[model samples]
Target chain A: MSVTRAWAWLIALTATSTAVAAIGLSGRWLALVVLALAWAKAELILNRYLHLAQAPNIARGFALGLALFMLALTSLAVAIP
Target chain B: MTTPQASVLDDLPGDLMMWVLILSELAVFGAGLMGFLAVRLTDPPGFAEAQAHLHSTGAGINTLVLVTSGWLAALALEAARAGRRARLRALLAGAALLGGVFLFLKAQEYADLWAAGLTFESHAFYTFHMLLTGFHAAHVLAGILLLGLVGWLATPRAVEAGAAFWHMVDLVWVLLFPVVYLI
Candidate 1:
């Protein structure tokens, strides 16, 4: 996608995330959704904004790292408290 | 002169150093997030209470501003690639201006928090909150200066590098929002 179109998606996603947070979600469900959304937004930036998609290996590596990181944090938040 | 495609990266868009900076910055932010999580999970009640005082409106506004600025930086990079000097300069300046807006809003947020007597010692949560946002703000400041310097230089490599750094800053804030403000 063109930079403009990618940016439009980012802004729209931000608005959606903000709205979701504002409405107040709770428990493990909230943790799951919020972490998932954050992961998706980060992926969007890495893939589109940073142009990492051109190098598939680098892109996959970064995605895996982010997934692991978010999974750990989400687990800590949801599993324990 | 070798065209950009012949410049060794073959697939990447910018210089090696900018990628290094990007990776390092991400690592640092990742560590910070982990640290914040460590403390937060320890005192869930304390953190949640302090977190409730946080103003998501400002965080959300800053998110919108930073993301838009990151787009402007991307456009500047595109213009640089196309050898559109004037467009590149204009986009860089616009991006820098938006970065300034981000800083202004961030400062306003900090000032409000301080006015309300939330300091680094206010609580463990506030400490991490201040550190994470403060460190990220420093990056935004550095990025604004880099954007202005690169706009004046107008070199494709320099401009792309600045765009990379600025976008990295935006990306950090993107991850930080849910962890620090909402969650």
Candidate 2:
């Protein structure tokens, strides 16, 4: 993707999260959506920003690490709650 | 222009040292977040109430601002790859300027907290709130300095390393905004 397109995605994703916050969902639902969006945004930056897409293995590692972090965060907040 | 040549591992960008720094920083922030979660779980009501007093709107806008800065840094990296020396410097400067804006907004938020007399000793929530964000803000400061240096130098490797660090700063805020303020 072009750099411009990548930036557009970044802005759009941030807007979604801001809207979600404004809407004021709480507890596990909020946790899930926010963390997931954080993961998505991080992934986009890893690929489009860092140009890690060229290094597929590294990108996958970062993606998996992000997924695990989000999962751990969600489980800690939601499952135990 | 730096071609973003893969490292010996063939899966990394920029210097291995920068990635190491990024991961180390993330680990530190991650540990802080885990501590925060533990505290919040113990006292959800107290934590949520404290969270309610925060300027979530400023944080939300800051998230956009920081991400936009990351986009600029990414464009700078692209410019480096394209051998556009002037564009690289310009984009890095823009990214650094946005970083300044992020700091300015955060300082406004901080001023309000100070005016309200909240401190590191105020409460468990505020303690972590200030600690984590304060540390992240320090990183942002470091990033802005690096961006300025790289922009001035206009060298590909410097630009790539600067972009890497700046993006790492942006990534942390993106993760922390919800954990610290909204959620």
Candidate 3:
């Protein structure tokens, strides 16, 4: 993907996540949605910005680590009741 | 003979040491975020209350600033490779300018929080807020210096390494924003 396209998506995703929170939404579901958006933004930076997509192994490793962290975050969010 | 995988590894972009630094920074921020959540789990209401004091809108603006700065840095890399020294310097300046904007917004947010009587000693939430985001702010400072240095040098390798570090800053904020302000 082109850098411009990746940047546009990054802006859109940032807006969406910000809007979600601005709407006064709170709960595990909100955490899940926002955190998922965060992961997507990070992926765009990793691939399009950092050019990690050219290094598939390294890219995949970072993706896996981010996924696990997000999962743990979700679990913690759910448990926060 | 070198295997395909070995060749692919060798093909990784930029200096290998930059990747090492990127990985280390990510690990540190990731652990800090996880620690935040663990502490919040122990006192959800208190955490939520402290979080409410934060300026999420300003942080959201900072996110856009950082991402746009990252884009400029990426373009700067292209310009450097194309041997367009003037354009490379201009792009790096633009990216660094946005970094300045981000820092300005962050300082404003910090001032507001301070005025509101939120300090590191107030609670676990405020403490993490100070440490994690303060650490990140320090990185932005470093990244700006790196961008300036690379632009002055006008070398492709310097540009590549500098841009990589700038994007690392952007990537961390993308995650840290939600964890600290929104979530």
**Highest TM-score model number:** 3
**Best first by DockQ, ranked:** 3, 2, 1
Worst 10 residues of 2 chain B by lDDT: B4-13
Give me the displacement of residue B20 in model 2, in angstroms: 0.8
Task: Give the best candidate by lDDT.
Answer: 3
Deviation from native of the Cα of residue A51 in model 2, angstroms: 1.5
Let me know the TM-score candidate 1 reaches against the reference structure: 0.93
C-alpha DockQ for predicted model 2? 0.65
TM-score for each model: 0.93, 0.93, 0.96
* True-vs-predicted CA distance for residue B136, candidate 1, Å: 0.3
Candidates 1 onward: DockQ, in order? 0.60, 0.65, 0.81
Q: What is the lDDT of residue B39 in candidate 1?
A: 78
Candidate order (lDDT)? 3, 1, 2
Residues B61-180, model 1: lDDT tens digits: 889999999999998988988999999999999998998998898888888889999899999998889899999999999999999999988888888789889989999998898888
Instruction: Give one digit per residue, the lDDT tens place, for model 2 in B107-173.
Output: 8888988898877787799999999999999999999999999888887898999999998898888
Q: A-chain TM-score per prediction?
A: 0.86, 0.87, 0.92
CA-based DockQ, model 3: 0.81
Model 1: lDDT of residue B35: 85
